[model samples]
Target: MTTPFVHPYLPNSAPEVRAEMLAAVGAESVEEFYADIPAALRLTGDLDLPEPLVAEADLSRHVRGILGKNRTRLSFLGAGTYHHHVPAVVDEVIGRSEFLTAYAGEPYEDHGRFQALFEYASLLAELLEVEVVNVPTYDSLQATATALSMAVRATGRTRILVASDVRADVLSKVEDFIRPYASLEHVPTVDGIADVAAVTALLGDDVAAVWVSTPSATGAVETAMTQLAEATHAVGGLLVAQTDPIGLGVLTPPAAQGADITCGDIQSLGIHAWFGGGHAGFVGVADDPRLVMEMPHRLFGLASTSVEGEYGFGDVAWDRTAFAHREEGKEWVGTAAALWGIAAGVYLALMGPQGMVELGETLLARTAYARKVLTALPGVSEADGAVHLREFVLHLPRPAAEVVEELRAKEIEAGVVLGEHELLVCVTEMTTQADIDLLARELGAVLGTATDATTHTPVLEEVAR
Candidate 1:
């Protein structure tokens, strides 16, 4: 088998770190770290097995004995972590020499050379239609923190308001990080969307920024940007949007809705399922160049003069001014190489603008179909006629936690419950008709068994003394 490319700081460095760690523990090495007078605590030699290493063919049989015990299942889980269908071309392109190999040997003296990696950030800026772009942070949570920090300082306000229906993970992050210096408020939602009147009532002079999650965690579509943006603008407060990137294909962009700071996870754009935890986000703005001026993460930029050396003439040349500003431009070198190579080069080439648009439409349609199918199941409940983005919530007969465990026992990975009995199910382009049917079937069985058992037993409600 071919050797997979290993990250520099993995098990390779574990052995070296162990040596120093053992010494600090008053021992010579790992063996000495646990070296006591008890011989029973230590093994004398290697495992009692064959002396010589077996051939590759024989080794495969040995490994299959252990791996065959566990069964792999279809996943329905999509609270924040989703399972996306990654194209084969993505893996192929990212594994190329230009991306996989270390370019540390390349001389920094050739600073003027516009490499392909740098061009990647430029293309992202074009896709987002923004003045600047940065793909530096590892995930969306970090990006949110960084964006909030920049917005607060830029507007010089100490209050931040977040929509009540924002992802719980993001809410906890904001509370923990911003609690030290700022006041945070949660604006309630009307029906499934944000309450525009409540937001307007809360808006005041002290408010620094207002954050909103379009197509909220409940999976309801909230096209409240027009009113929300206006409310924020009235008080000199900035509007920040947390959106799903795929939804932008059809829905109005936050920038078009007059948002001052637009940022969200770009994981839907050709990212893999396995990379969910580390998939980063992008922040875009329309009017504020200062938002990108001192961003926490880095971004790449290009240089183009009106005319070559036109600003320089005779003894009053401004050559130094160009270089001075050039060094401060944004760039992310290593991690972004794969995103550029695969998404821009291959995915775009294969699927033109119309194809990408169609993909987004299909995802929305599929989500709608899945929601109807789930709602039609026995002992299941949901909103009557609410439009969903790509996921929806359901109330089940049994406790949400018990239902989740039952689904897992049958080799099915289901969604998480936000409240005591409510679970959110997400359907993406990857969810086939068969996958949806299996989920419906499994859910019906579990709910029926739970319902019958509960009815036969005596009900006891706890009463307060």
Candidate 2:
């Protein structure tokens, strides 16, 4: 297709352009709408790229050939991204017209994209049981960083204590970004859990926020929120919880656990697990007026009041009554993918609270079962027994790289082992019992067939521990 030049200004809006357009169309009045642009901006030069088009099937086959160069495997890896099964119905439902409204609330300024944002934000607030939400930012890292910056501004504290076993990349990113502004301190871990004593020692006059992750990156659960919140409260600091939304289904929310700021990824909620996004991160605060106003992203709410003549129905708008600054008020163009994806998430949520909980429970149970099966296999063993959420790490008797290679050769994709021996495996609601057995059977066969397989599996098992 040839590129067309669009006018920067409208003919109907500009008197000269309107007259020119009328003359070009041989029309007596402006009402005759068909028009052509002036020859000056129109190109007479030849266009360079793709002068000719290929047949549809040929093009498709070419694209497929390029794509097929990449190897396919039954993925068992999940660090942040999981291979969850997305229902086909999700795509169909998100395409509905009712959900495609823009964020602009007024008739004159109605930008339909913002309405989708508002709808998404409202859905998240209702799911999280928070007063408001802002559906901006591409991922959780931005959300956390923004919230941390806001917390620093609000608290005037230069010291922030973070848990030792937090997500590795998130911590690295936060340290790289936040350390330039304040003193970033790490809370020591006690058996894969955040050490309360270490965090307590670090707290005092200059502390702004205390961050801890639940189901720590090592797969250990932390139940210290109440005390953590109390300690932060006593020292005039905020307790921030970075949660796994999948765990949220079965576990207590940050608000229920007394966390002042609840910030985490919503990736597990009906969004495709493609590259760990396009998931929205939520930063909700406890219902305290003092705390809620400090929330970073602001969602529009339906507010009502009487007009001069009579009562009137107010339309949708972004509500900032409980937010901090004007910068947060900018209308975020709803990423079409996330808005549509999360609407599916709302459908997942609306299927009822029980269904959500069951989804979480099912994941937990299946993950546990898969763990047992993996451990029973020849070269695999459980590395940590720290009460995993949906996934846990395993120690492979063979080198993780080698085992992953072997699995790949067999068209089975397995997890990557961190350090020297640990392989992280995630079992979502999508991982079936059959899939689990397939992994087990494959590992068992790899133990017998490959060169020194018998020796490597045992040697790897010892190295795994």
Candidate 3:
């Protein structure tokens, strides 16, 4: 059977027209084009795909029906990406054609685009309390790897130390990029935060940098960063911070802690998790020109013009990207992700400093309430002793994966399952007190042996680290 050209945008060519084109190309059949693909590897049957819809309305409804099946859960799951409440105006401003367009450094056609990104970097710099911030990278993982690369370049060292509890995805990316060039080391964590004592023990002349993630994998805020920074610097190594941009609203800025390079995902600012839709990454440089010069991606700078009080946005150290010169570029990232950077800038401009602090306080409050409520359950107890802000670990009577599936049946996204025993639950500004109460009730109901949610687990005092 012949393949049906069904999409309205795709023109259906007549058999004679196809024959004429093939004849012109000196080929008798379409199969001739695939002669080099190896007969055994070629598919033997028609693709088992649904027929395409001809009407735009039909296509829209069809897609909607598929998406409608995704249960809008009362979610508490944040292993990394989170579901934050995105304000309405952020989408409105970014959707405008002036800001929505994509490219790298088009000085003439898209000066507004350049300026938007500049404002984003500037606002993020202020929020992070760092001197300089780059235009976004792909995600936190990409930013971490890129930051590590810059550290190695700046310090001229072959050994790098990573906190074992830093997100596994980030470590894998850093390892992928740094291998065959630099050696990798781990600084272990105790009670969900990096063990600062071990970090001091591990730092040496051969080490180029130390990386630690705040509001770490278990959602425990790593408070010992200041000590880690001092130790890394005493040995002449840079401190690289893997952070959540939203956490900076309330937490100490890495720069204040003496971080040489700070990097992470900015997804929580205005971007939605969108069920793992792509997000942009960020890297902020401390007050060092050498490290600033080695930044992996674009850095938009504000400039003053000859006209009185006139200003503009442009690339600083304009030669850093692969856009103009691919082979010799520092990194191969493109400019589309910068669009997310622009959206984030809009978010910051709207939130301002006060809004950021308010957001942080709100998250802190909600998570605290959640931890208090959840731990009251009979079979659920705090998995670690760390004081958490946005997330916490819980030990359940049964397998967390099994519990998660039961919760899913009740329309809840739940938390990350570490194994048969542990569950990493996250709370955000979006998770209301009612949602937390419902979560407590559901977990109590699903565990089969749970008493009412108000009953404290008997081991609470024993595991209350």
After superposing candidate 2 on the true structure, give the runs of residues whose Cα lies further than 4 Å from its correct spot.
Answer: 1-72, 97-123, 126-129, 305-341, 447-465
Best by TM-score: 3
- Local distance difference test, candidate 2: 0.65
lDDT of 3 at 155: 84
Residue 24, candidate 3: alpha-carbon lDDT? 93
Best by lDDT: 3
Of 1 and 3, which scores higher on TM-score? 3
Assess every candidate by TM-score: 0.72, 0.75, 0.85
Query: What tens digits encode model 2's per-residue C-alpha lDDT throughout 413-439?
Result: 777567577777777776677677777
Error of 3 at 301 (Å): 1.5
lDDT against true structure, model 3? 0.80
Candidate 1 structure quality by residue, lDDT tens digits, 356-434? 6787788788888888888787778884345787778888877999999988887777677767888888888777766
Give Cα-based local distance difference scores for all models: 0.64, 0.65, 0.80
